[model samples]
Target: MELLYSNILPLGCDDDERTIVGCFKEQMKNSDRVEIAVGYTSNASLNELDALIDRYAIKKICLTIGMYYIEGMPERSYHTALRVNQHWKASGIGEIRIVKPFKYHGKLFCFYKNEKPFSAIIGSANLGVIKLEATNRRQYEISALTINETEVAEIAFHIEQLKTSICSGNISDIKGMPLIRETNTSLDGIELVTAVPQSSVEFYKNCKTYVSFFLKLKVPRSVDRHIDDGKHYTKSNINVCYAAPRNKRKSRDWYETQLTVGSDIYRMEGYPNKNEPFFVVTDDGYWFKAHTTSDNNKQFSAVGDELIMGRWLKGRLVAAGIVKHVNDTALDADRLGMITEEMLEEYGCDSLLFKKTGQTALDEKGTDLDVWMLSFVSGNDYER
Candidate 1:
């Protein structure tokens, strides 16, 4: 048995081997599967674990999260977990489960080799201890690493008990659970902006320079037939941008999200130019750098990173509870993966409105750029 303390030394000087993340990685080196039961966790922690899973060639990870039964999980975290589970499920990697009926505050991680428990970490650290972010403050945690065969088996048994159908349920089960509708709204790191009410005629009257377009385009029934007729079909515009093609050879697929703009709209005086990046503050308070590119400057996308724009728009819908969260594994036939006309209609709005705020802000590189506001609120009726 070995004791581990996260803050034995000064903040940044602590030994990486003693920290939760480092300890987990070291254990993963000898194990192919792991089972974790933590009081609470975050999306960042899951992302960290996901990376480790690939790096270590982990075959499976079974996570049983507690605390959500007492204090509802944050909507973002819940949705992120769902998306992560979807990926894992599609890949036959693992599953994430939630405790039920009673609250469990224990934190334990058991690593297995060839389906036999070999080691375990019992501690005070939640899954968040693994995330190494600049903004996250280091937390003090005391845990024990035990390789004793008897102790490892005992701890593994407890976790297995928690996995029983009666004791816990898969993350997907929450969707049908009565308490699933209750989600904590305390979104950390995300700014929530109060949108100008669409019913406010005065606000619309004063906003004349705005451009609005539908999120889901009306696609012809047969794209192949259309191509046969010499029509160029850009799948990026028809489907949600986040699911952009993974074809490395095609420059169009390189841009994750591409929404086609009308020539008149793209040619608007003072609008952003081709490849000229600008800051965008969405009505939902998400901010990103954006630019117009492609032939005729008709493709609007987030500057540099491709997933930013799609995440912003799709994330908003997920938060609104109007759409299900999805990942790259989501198929085109999975309506949950793509923004469909039906989703927009259910959201009570079919288009997004973009208007230059007439403001300027310095980007990460310290370049001054125009700031634009994007609104996708329901009932918003904007003129072309």
Candidate 2:
């Protein structure tokens, strides 16, 4: 037998932190696979959620935000979420797959693998704080329905594309697929449907008719707040904080500190060719902060002869002093300025600096074709 659950708990509803936590604690015990998918509002904390995953050895976690690995070795299983869908994009996770958010009255979906008496749910209840806990609110929302056989297949198919993206590194366009699609029988005596049933044509025309009449039928928005360090800020409480503190050091300074701590450092910046932007990278992106600029006046000036990060040039490092040369003659010099510069050459690898386009105005008086065009014509020869 299948069970269904749904609700109308919007973003600003209540401020309770544990209702959803309790829900997870209760539902997760017997759950072989637990998927916590949230849209406009998020209920679970990254740490608490990850702990749940660890406790249950969850097979999959599809969050709207990029999921983190708070404890154990990264799960071999795929964890997929949208890049712009929510926050926490800087964690450097490998399987950070992108997804789109569902809309209000948009069939919300969750797929739990391994838990029998298949219990599927949809509604306004988000797994988060205000939606479940806060009081002195005008209304609260909740909805849920146990699934019949067909609904099971439908929900399974709804999230299959999401599962494929995490496991195989591919995602399909949601628009191409219907909200509910028929699935072949897998579990006994149950027809399956998509976990997120698309708003029926009738529902689309008039959402209020299908959604619960008890709750005020209006779309809710997440209160805007600053996300500093790793903490999430909401409007109701100005002082909310997270487990991790923000690194106050500027990103570049932190990067430099990590790389120069151990070895003498050197930097080089210039385009190897006209098409490439000048780049400054450390032995590994792990060490020095890399930067790129298109200014032609930024030239290479070094006293050392080492080639670092797959390119040749001159710059200072905190550990190593100024590089003197990029050739055999100047090689013996300590090259170890406070920031030393030595070329640790290796094959099949390059520095952490990735590619990006930079902009500079076109010159008008030089011998270059752009300059010549500008001198000869009425329009600016816009070339760099």
lDDT of each: 0.67, 0.28
TM per prediction: 0.53, 0.30
Cα RMSD of predicted structure 1: 11.4
**What lDDT is reached at residue 316 by model 1?**
60
Q: Per-residue CA lDDT of candidate 2, range 36-137, in tens?
A: 343333222343555555676655455432222211111111111222112222322122232433221223345465543355555554544223335313
Weakest 10 consecutive residues of candidate 2 by summed lDDT: 370-379
Residues 247-325, model 1: lDDT tens digits:
6443232214457777767776766689988876665445567888988788878766665665666666666555665
Top of the candidates by TM-score: 1
